[model samples]
Target: MQYPIKKNSLVDETIRTIRQHIRQQTWTLNERIPSEAELVELFGIGRNTIREAIKILAYLGVLDVCQGDGTYVRAVDDFSESIVLLNRASLHDHLETRCLLEIEIARFAARRRNAEDIQNLQALLALREKINPLEDLEEFWIRDRDLHLAIAIASHNQALHATYRYFLSTSYEYTKLFIQDEDLAEPDHPAHETLVAAIISGDENQASAYARALLMPTIQQLEQLSTT
Candidate 1:
């Protein structure tokens, strides 16, 4: 509320500061934001400028503007608004983004993981391996995603961990699309096993290589699907 406001672009600056406040949890998710009058006073801006900023954020899915009630925080950020398109993006595109996220996650995990992290990852991977995807794809997918999530958590990077956690929910739906359409075989569990081992051993390059190795087959499958 006490942010410095530049004169020329009051609306944009108001929007930016409001977003910062939300990000910092000054205004929490589902919590109603300050009223236009309060915001006008807090920001030293006009009612019109405050209303316009709130309207723009509401459009971006970051805030929910109610009829009689005040505006409320809808999501943590704007990424929630674009999830529909992200889920519908090409299989190759999804895999490409997954590669970028997971590869870095693996490297960070390798460098940052502790004994407890190793133990947790091993347990998740074991549970993942035991579930035959063909028998129970949903259960198998959940376990698989959990193991990757453990690795992301082991990275000890809050921003990266949060981003991956949010992204995985979107990717899971699209991943199911290819698995159903292509009748894909069981995932390369051994490759994942090696990736976990690399992290435990603190070998960053090996961890990253294993992570990429695990995803390469899916990329190739998507390419083949496109060609056919």
Candidate 2:
């Protein structure tokens, strides 16, 4: 039941370790986990860290913490468990998956977008244009994510929108890694303009092609990073 919390990112390390333990079947469904006190001793961490880690697991439906009772493992099938594992995938994998998702989303948006969706996409693009990525990286990153999510929303496929949002949330840290690169300091305004125009024009082929072009540089960079 003892676990060593890594020196870096203690809370995140603890969460990963506990999730691994559950995946390994060291803990079964309905089986109560070690107490907060025990976990404190197990991980050589304070109560707050253990509590926070447990709370996160509970929120993810991996654990059920009952007041006046201990926390129990919740049922998780292979499919559900895979979703949790997706969050742990490498940045390269995340980008690859995102590229595929965006391409399909662009195609769908081109076909199904309405006047309101066009207006929303234009608004986001306008906000994006104001951001100078070199001068304001954080704002640039936020606007970039919002613009892509807006396109996904315009797809009118609720399932695609939901999946895209989930991927954005889970791969956020990795996305930040790419945005911080000096090589990526310049925003691709023309690409964004072209993509939006294509979608608004209902040119699914152009929209999909533009989406791929938009993400291709990031994908290639990640590929190089993986090799080196």
Candidate 3:
């Protein structure tokens, strides 16, 4: 099926349209995105608009398309945008995303991480431990942020590392915005211990799953509070 070219390309508009559809449950991950023909008909946009939108979503890790195979939702839980939202998002959202991303990546890191990466991660973890539990909130968060950065950098993917770096910066500033979230100020969270153990033991699934479990309660707590 051929899609008509638009007189003026609307890449941003196309993207917005796609996002709305996804958010509205019009399409799902692993399901084919609306065809270019459908998009052209509905939006009266050009083929270039459709193509650009597809390409951008693919970059954002939202949708996947194969040359022979149709496009599919990558994962309903895909958090590329979530990571990009690290800055503007709430502290709770930031924590949830970080825990999920790290644990998943940590599992991969356990299997694929090189010695140098391991060393780097270990050093960062150690540095985190040296900070007094009684330290100021700012200092605690600094070390806390460092631990997340270490894991991402240890993954050794330039794109992943860079994405996480930006997330860290945003999260650091945003975390400072709240003074009442004291639980995260703890110097030793058992989840971090499990994370390190899993990485060292080369158990990716264990690592990622543990990381998710560690943060799940906090997410629930946040939800409960938000409702009230």
Candidates 2 and 3: which is better by TM-score? Answer: 2
Question: TM-scores of the models, in the given order?
Answer: 0.66, 0.64, 0.56
lDDT tens digits by residue: candidate 1, 1-228: 455578988888888889889989999999999898888788887899888988898889899999898789998878543686786788789887888999999999999999899999989988988987768879977998899999999999999999899888877676576567655432478888899999999999999998888777778877887899
Candidate 3 regions exceeding 4 Å error are 1-86, 177-180, 183-187
lDDT of each: 0.86, 0.85, 0.71
- Candidate 2's C-alpha lDDT? 0.85
Which TM-score value belongs to model 1?
A: 0.66
Pairs of residues clashing in candidate 2: none
Ranking, TM-score, top scorer first: 1, 2, 3
Clashes of each: 0, 0, 5
Better of 1 and 2 by TM-score: 1
lDDT ranking from best candidate downward: 1, 2, 3
Task: Give me the candidate number with maximum TM-score.
Answer: 1
lDDT measured at residue 181 in model 3 versus the true structure, 0 to 100: 63
Which candidate gets the maximum lDDT versus the true structure?
1
